[model samples]
Target: MKKVTLKKNLSAAMISLLALSSFGGTVHGESKTGINADAAILVNAETGKIVDKYNEDQPLGVASMTKMMTEYLVLEAIDKGKIEWTDTYKISDKVYQLANAPGLSNVPLRAGDAYTIKELYEAMVIKSGNGAAIALSEAVAGSEGEFVKRMNAKAAQLGMEHYKFVNSSGLSNYDMLGMHPEGTGVNDENMVSAEDMATLAYRLIKDYPEVLKTSGTNYKYFRKGTDEEYLMKNTNALLKDRAYSYKGADGLKTGTTPFAGSTFTGTAERDGVRYITVILDAKDQYGQPSSAERFIQAAKMLDYGFTQYETVQYTLDDTETKDALPVQDGKEAEVKITVDKPIKVRMMKKEIKQAGVELKLDKDKTGEDGKLQAPVEKGEKIGELVLKNEKEAEYILDGLQRDQKVNVYASSTVEKANWFVRSARNIGEFLKDIFG
Candidate 1:
């Protein structure tokens, strides 16, 4: 059997489903008690398909959510062998200034204190530490200015066009509190569109899956090496057993600032379908004391995704041929074609039948027996296959504006016959002409 690792998504806690009977129409129109956000989006993590979208293109200040990129770049540096888990970075005066700054989201760090890769990463991710973020930025690129450049470059590389990062920590330029480095050209808070935010989180999870190990941890301690330890609470309230405890919610990040209000990128998985929700600039709950508006909106969006749509995974087996084609002038009479690799197509269960899933052969390359000629190699291009419903196809062709033209491949190989085998065909042709 071919080796393929499929992590089951459903959990026992998900057994008690929240029957979103009231907020069903929130996706289409605004509700008084629905997701209170200026922009929001829920995406199918598997297919990159949008389930619910509201003003997702409008760029808004992302605040601490910027750490997602910060964390990603750190992990990427480690992956590239430029850094290591044991490597330590000393806290600089700039880092201490930010950490001690009034009202900044950061753990207290004294100047010259050193933190290892694992410790600082946990503080940055779980505590949303501005100090840790800036420290890592300096360690990675030698300066916050250079790190911000890399951040913007990485965003563009990931196709996140609607993103701008001016600082490692997502603090606004206006809210700098005179803590940024002298003559630093930083002039803006982090800005990101909902769609781009989800794309960033999706890419981060896909590329560095180990991020979940820290992002999912609910609590930890920073400065474990010293007595000045600070308790770090995972800012993502959706993951905790709170009023909006989403069963499968693991992480991403959350941000709240007076100007940005609240921002969040939450990730969850249920029944094989992974969901990512982005909410930016959410309304602060009127009279509610806690900073839970983002978490509530994230939970509502995730619940809507899980209940409104059912995902079906179609096993795209590339090893076995669902159909075979007869070969000509070859050692073998036929050749088998299939998908080139084991893949899964996750889509709305309702779209399965109407998805217009048709398996077509490369007719232009076929032989007289309606099959490709011999000498066909395994995994050779044969044709095209699309897992799409009418809406999906139109979305790609029109509004959603996706360009995906992929080719299907053959599953097996076939070799050509030698000269003696060609003589047999020549003899048959000669006999047929004589009889005629």
Candidate 2:
């Protein structure tokens, strides 16, 4: 297996195919965003831009939503050849008991019977099975205790600011029935802020998109054709045919615990844009815990994202780059530069028309006088040109203008000037200085 490195961000073009082909590119009117939740956030998955947010940074229990990180590590291990989907793990008595425990979300695991990693992964993702999660954790890291360490390490590596992973599953230690990972408090539950949840979701999709194949399924049978056959339905209610089904809704996780309430991380694609949303500890209008409440909150945010934003090609306008760079001792006195590639950004439809580009040249490539040295090659790297909207404030993470950026490159090669021509130019400059 090839090693996979975590990518900080993905280009919109990479997932553009998920967009609807029928979209006519018209921007929809903005809608009011009034979300009732302890914390909520809407993010443009491609650009990692925060579209709508409320109390996004407040850390709160994530309940089973914490399994997303577990899912990520399992996928990472597979990618790194540490494990295979075909690898089978024998069911231990502890895992079998946990799987059979009353009132917990789980699929039956027979003691002394071996189940493939793929089988357990499906159980964990589609059914939010606590037992399956612990089993997979042990398979990957030898024990839930060691796996919890890996979970926290991966969270820190991913830049999650407010988060703690006490166990492989998101269950509070009390829910673990004294089988919680060693060193964790009895009632400690997985905790994370809405913003960080979005980050984790984004990385999971970006890294192991194949996980969606299982998570998106409405239902599947575990241990099919056998006496132990059990049907596992995806917990993400927003999937097709579910009670709160929404178009383009697919793959993500839902969580609920006495402490966490109802929480969801949802994603949808439309018109060449995808948005990831998180609604944590949501309540219905009556301010009561309801499974449907998180879906409703997620729908509101998804609706706002789909209707209020537009993805369009961001190119250098015809009049933006007429200026040329002076080249010292080159065949030509100046070299023209242009954008190296096409850039796309998801922005509020109302603000698209107000966007402008700013050119930034690389200082290292040029001389003290801010001129390129001769022998410049066509398409040579120079610097990046940033797209900015004067009307918009930097609302996402700092330095992440979410502005479309493309490298600027030399449009044509400029050969070095001949010795005679160089001498004549130098002499002319010296004479002019003496005369002055």
Candidate 3:
């Protein structure tokens, strides 16, 4: 049986979930709340904030959504130059056999048949072709087992502690005893948490925007030989029409199995903001539309995000500067410190007045003289600025800390202070100290 591993990395925003016991605040109810799947998560693609969640950290059979990881690994290979769009891969017997396997999605490649890496990627993502995934794995790593090692390793690297992979095709069934009574362990499947799936989806699109170009394609055709051409349609019906369209609802992966249920990683972008939603065990039967329920949940969460929260730049304006620190043994007497950017937070319009900034400094670095020494670089750490509101104490804070020792680099004349001049100055200082 195949084995696989995966991990999750929470962004600072999502890390805030640790502070809240639940994300159901304000948003409630079975129908209105964004919790339609057995496991679901809606996170800000850019900020990684948990907008809504239901059994998000719970591990469940993810079915074809396992292909999201496969897609991730493939894009990584392409980004790192291990594979290229134009590169051709020779079909192997293993992949060919899997392609012909009943109930498996495949691109129908025969042994010795070749297709470009780009074409295989489209088949895997657009058509949900398991055989295409196996072929790509072999092409990049020489064997399905070895590629799976890479998959698990990558998962660990991504901090997805709850995931494990058994095969490139996600067909392993080692843990399906309760779900499948036929005693078939051969269908070794890939597993991951809803949070981990969202993490993978975010990273894939953020790192390899090109994958979207292929995943968003609604249809494609590949020729295996002069006489045979396989016309493939995208398995994601959501992409078929404009009726249920959501802006930036681009390419992503979906999956289903009798044991795993319906699962999907759906990504959408609007007004420069991107969001990733993961739903696991969303359906009661195969080839069903239960995954769409999660999409509705995602839309609600995203709408709330855009309308309820606002990102503000809080850079230190000159008008806000209370005072400048003096510089000793430097051409300039002082330097200005300011906030880098405005922070974003969710709040009601009436609560805007409650937002304020607090500045602090490193106590050890600040001298009693209240002046910085020479050789200060531009944009050097001088102080930290924290932004907070009444409801949430602190929403965002810049890394810069107060009293952080800053250099005051000498100007043109000071730059000419050579070793002799420095030594002469040191000798004069020593003589003055002894006399005193």
Candidate 4:
């Protein structure tokens, strides 16, 4: 058997049955639901709330969606001053050959030809050019193999729960014309769970919003007004002017292969609210692989998000308790408690209705009588005020708790009571107990 991974062994009928069991059957209309993919996820870009998901944690082939990682590492290098947009690379023989490979998406590049980092970055981002991606990878880390290590390391740092990068371009090693990164199998392909892809997209947008400038563009000329000029059209069909154009569709990336089928990591913003959606190995109704199917599924995820979700702010007053915590051995008998700050969450209209905060105090800091010990400094962390939702347990994004919580701090300092005051209070309590 070949050493390939990420492709499922289920038949079309079995896949559909799995979808129905996982999502309660495909529905219709404005409340439309269900996605025809092996795995999918929708999330609030600002709040990191997973709005909905289907089999989002299963590791699967991501195809060129892996380029998002390549893009991230390049941007990071530029930000760290390790490289510059004006920096240039002389096309390597392997990259040059891959650029001209038949059937693979690429921008024309000749061996020994020098291209600026900016030009190659555009080719990779705007056109999903495999050669451009590999070239940029080599420039950033000195070799595609080293760059692949950086990609996996960055994925872990970004809180990605499940991912594997065998090569920078996401192409099967066999497709690399025998030039795939050393130590990786020739049949290997990049793999990531939909949840991890969402996490990657979130970190990309958060860490470098500048990427949208390139990914958002629908088309651009690789070498404008030159003899070797080649027009590169964005592979994202949801972009404006495309056959399946959608409003506010700007970035991020799309991919397809016999192994990965069709996948997309899409981001869009409208009225200041942004959402990130991921669809992996999307298939048509009959369970046949189709490039257009990913967009169709993405449309449903985006529509449900935009139409049903809203950003709501929860403040200190929203917490379940405003009661003061009794202080033991302090000059003052009690101290005020409240949430540290306001938290913003993107929730469905229904989730908002039942949304509220729950207060939890630290037991270690409290006395046997359930009172806080004295010498409490102003702004001391005593506990946490957590956002509570009835449906929170059902939310996806595996290994990610979506912990929307803030530290509960003391309103003011409560110094320890002097010996005299302590004695007096002790006597008073003794007398009260006897008289009662």
Q: Report the lDDT tens digits of candidate 4 across residue range 70-186.
A: 999999999999999999999999999999999899998998999999999999999999999999999999999899989988988887766789998878677898999976877
lDDT of each: 0.72, 0.81, 0.62, 0.83
In model 2, the Cα lDDT at residue 90 comes to 92
Q: List runs of model 2 lying over 4 Å from the truth.
A: 1-32, 322-329, 333-336, 364-375, 390-403, 416-436
Per-residue lDDT tens digits for candidate 3, residues 200-222, read 77677777788777777777776
Residue-wise C-alpha lDDT for candidate 1, range 1-436, written one tens digit per residue: 1211110111111111211332112224553236677778888776677777786665666889999999989999999999998999998888888888887888888888888887778889999988888899999999988898899899988877566678888886655666553335434456677878888898898899899889988988776666887789888887767567788888889887654567889999877678899887776656331367778778788877787665443323421344566667768877766654333454455665664344456787667666566677888887765444536421101233352334677667878899898799879989999997
Among these predicted structures, which one has the highest TM-score?
2
Which portions of model 3 miss their true places by more than 4 Å? 1-32, 172-187, 224-227, 238-243, 283-291, 318-335, 339-353, 368-379, 390-436
Candidate 2 residue pairs in backbone clash: none
Q: Summing lDDT over every window of 10 consecutive residues in candidate 4, give the lowest-scoring window.
A: 23-32
Q: What are the models' TM-scores?
A: 0.77, 0.84, 0.71, 0.80
RMSD of each: 11.5, 11.2, 9.8, 5.7
* Candidate 3 global CA lDDT score: 0.62
Best by lDDT: 4
Give me the runs in candidate 1 sitting further than 4 Å from their true place: 1-34, 181-187, 284-290, 313-322, 326-337, 340-343, 367-381, 388-390, 393-436
- lDDT (0-100) at residue 63 of candidate 1? 81
